[model samples]
Structures are given as C-alpha cells and as structure tokens.
Target: MSAHSVPAPLPCPAAIRLHCAGPLEAVVVAALQRACFPEDPWDDASVATLTAPPTGFAVIALDGQEQPVGFAMARVTAEDAEILAIGVLPQARRGGIGRCLVEAVAAGSHGRGATALFLEVAEDNQEAWTLYKVCGFFSVGRRPGYYRRRDGRVAALVLRRNLDGA
Candidate 1:
C-alpha cells in the first residue's frame, strides 16, 4: 500500500461536527498531527497550550464515527489572530475538512473581535497556499528561510486575511 493509503476515504456526511478541543481530545489531535505532519508533530505540551483559553483556540472535526480527522489551531490577541497550525489526515484531504477547519477558526476569531487573521505557509506548499487564497487570504509578505527543513534548507510565505470583509 502507498504511504497515504492507510485511512480509506470516508464519505463526509452532513452530520459532521466541529467542537472545541479539551484535554480528552489530545490523543486524537496527536494522531492527526502524526498522520498529517509527522516530521513536526505537536508535543503534548504544545497541544495543551493551544487548547488553553485567551491565548489560543483549537477545533476538531469529527466524522459520523466520532473520530477526529481534521483540526485547526490558532493564537489570538485583541486585534489579530494567527493560524498556528492546521491539517487533515491524508485520506481526509480534498474532502472539505481543511475548509471547515479554517471556517471554524475564522468564525471563532471574528466572534472574539479579531479584525484580521494571519498564517505562514511553507513556500513549497502550493496546495495550502491555494486553499488559503480561496479562503480570502492574500500574500502580505515573505520571510526568507522562515521554515527549517529536514535537509537544512528554509523557505516561507506569509499570508493574511481581513476577517471583517473576508
């Protein structure tokens, strides 16, 4: 089997739900991180920090089986919110999970009075860049060598969206 063929593509039902992350959700979140980004999976401490109040937000997307297949994490202040991380298990990609996660975060941030949201994507991550653009984010700047790769090279692109108008 191929590396991405572990989880079969499950039909996304209309009943899918998004919920706030809690301590009990850590394991699922870790699983998602491992599946989506094993090279830089979040540690327990980091997940704990992201689920804490005031400084951060984390949302999980649960399928009909009540299994988590997607997630998004963000950090927010009075005026701005930053998408700290987001991912969907390989089988879950291209099925609207990522969009749902982004929308969930955007709604939460808007409710908290954030006027804008920002995120940094790897320069080579064209798929993610396209997704963010479709979600109303636009290139605001670039940070050369912002992301360190396993092979020692670095590249990054900064993107932002105005929550009020977008």
Candidate 2:
C-alpha cells in the first residue's frame, strides 16, 4: 500500500469484540491509551478515576486474539453524556475498531439514560471527524486552541449525537 493509503478494512470486522471496562481493567486501558496517544497518555490511576462507576464508564475493544486494541471513556450527567477519550492503536486503524468502540460507548451512555452523547475532536483530525460524522454526530460548538500539538495548538470541534433512538 502507498504511504498515504489506508489498508483495506478487515474482512471479518465482527471479530472485534467489545467489553465494558472498570477499575480492574484500568491498567490495560492505560496501556492502550499510551500506545494510541503517545504525546498525551493517561496513567492507570487516572483511567480508573475517569472511568469510575455510576456516572462514568469505559469500553475496551479486543481483537479476535482477545488483545486489547482500543478503548473509549465516557461520563453521563443527567441527560447528557460526553466521551472523554477514545483511541485505537495505529497498527489496528482503518479496521473498524474505532467505530466499534464509539458505538459501544454510545450504547452504554444510552443505557445510562443519556439523551445525547458528545465528544470533541481536533479540527485537523479529518479521519476522526469523518468517523464521528458518519456515526451521526454533528458539530455543536468549537473551542479554540483546545488541543495541544507539537506544532502548536488546534481548535476542537465539539460534536453531539442524539441517543434518543439508541
């Protein structure tokens, strides 16, 4: 494949499995976060804190081999839920892992009585933006200089998806 070309999606994308993650899996989730976001990795303790029970929850995506490949963390407050973070390992990208994780988080949020799910993506992240758009998310707001990059800072586009039908 060309350097800029993405690999074709896995033939059996369904092989990817998803499971709810709790404090017990915080270490695994932290490792995935670090692998996916080397520039800003969260430690195990922080992951546990963010994905604590009640208002917060997290999902872990496992490959067919049952190896953790991705994770998504979210929190629900009242009728609103926000995705705090999500990541799929670089080696596992373009294979529907990210989409699966997003769907899992949305479903979990809805199960928690959330009417809407929200997430923020860096404006320059075209791949993630497209994924969210395809997942029924729409831009609702923007925060300037929200994401710190090696070059500088990038604006964050806040996107929301209604979970009323979820």
Off by over 4 Å in 2: 1-12
lDDT of each: 0.78, 0.86
Would you list the clashing residue pairs of candidate 1?
none
lDDT of 2 at 155: 100
lDDT tens digits, residues 46-69, model 1? 687776787787788878797888
Per-candidate TM vs. native? 0.86, 0.90
Residue-wise C-alpha lDDT for candidate 2, range 1-166, written one tens digit per residue: 2332222223227677677788888999899999998999899999999999898888887788988888889999999999999999998999888887788787788889999999999999999999999889999999999999999999999999999975
- Model 2 lDDT vs. the true structure? 0.86
Best by TM-score: 2
Model 1 TM-score, all chains together: 0.86
